[model samples]
Target: MFVECCGCKYYHDMPSNIYEAMANPEAVIRPRGNVGFTGALSMTVKCPWCSHEMSTKCCAGYAAMVYVKERLH
Candidate 1:
């Protein structure tokens, strides 16, 4: 699936499952402009199977969780 950031033109390839995507560090972060704020921007993506539009919260949360898990291990 493809994910596009609503705040910017940034886009990424998302895995079918959140956990799987989280496993890859590179897939978790995207370059964002200096908005002088800290939070995940909303994003919309087209579903490859049905061409439906989908939305997700900030990816930062997912990345942070994964980082925490890794540190604990």
Candidate 2:
């Protein structure tokens, strides 16, 4: 997945382990230094290139969730 930086307009590629981390929080690296994400439907992540904060809901993760919900129901 790619995260676009609002500051620099850079698209940062997300780690491949992100899906595993979403399913199991303990399985991924914390890029933003102990940002708490417990019980949250979405998260705030920093743009790797520009250090600009962005919402995870804008990413494909939420779309994937919607797709899964549609497929399941």
Candidate 3:
């Protein structure tokens, strides 16, 4: 999975265990200097290429799609 940075337009490859992390109730990734909830279904991380705060909606969407596919299969 990849996330696109809005500031620099860089594509970031998500971790393999991202779904597991997101599913964990205690798992919360907050970017430095950022406060408040990013979104109900999203997390925030710094862009490796540009140091910009990026939302993990792409990762979340990918996980949801994969979960649905697994359930359907």
Candidate 4:
């Protein structure tokens, strides 16, 4: 599984179990810290390609979410 950055179209690799995450009726997927997502969501992330701040409603490690890719953009 993988995700893409809306800005750059960069693909972010996702977990193999991602299908299950989407299959669960109770599973909620939304960008982390994104107010657009209501209630407790899944993950927070940043774009490695464009250095843009981003979030996802999937399972991504915190290590992948720590880069500050903005301001330089």
* Per-model RMSD to reference: 13.8, 11.9, 11.9, 10.5
Q: Rank the candidates by TM-score, best first.
A: 3, 2, 4, 1
Candidate 2 per-residue lDDT, tens place, 1-73, comes to 5555556767656665554453344343545545666433444366666665554444344322213445544
32-71 per-residue lDDT for model 3 (tens digits): 3445646434353666677765554433323223334455
Clashing residue pairs in candidate 3, if any? none
Candidate ranking (lDDT, best to worst): 4, 3, 2, 1
Give the poorly placed runs of model 1, Cα more than 4 Å off. Answer: 19-73
lDDT of 4 by residue, 28-72 (tens): 664445466466555334565777554445333322455666785
Error of 2 at 21 (Å): 8.4
Q: Model 2 — which ten-residue stretch has the worst lDDT?
A: 59-68
CA lDDT of 60 in candidate 3? 31
Model 3 regions more than 4 Å off: 16-44, 57-73
Q: What is the lDDT of residue 62 in candidate 1?
A: 25
- Winner by TM-score: 3
Candidates' TM-scores?
0.26, 0.34, 0.39, 0.33
Taken over the whole model, the C-alpha lDDT of each candidate is 0.45, 0.50, 0.51, 0.52
lDDT, residue 54, candidate 2: 54
How many residue pairs clash in each candidate at the backbone level? 0, 0, 0, 2
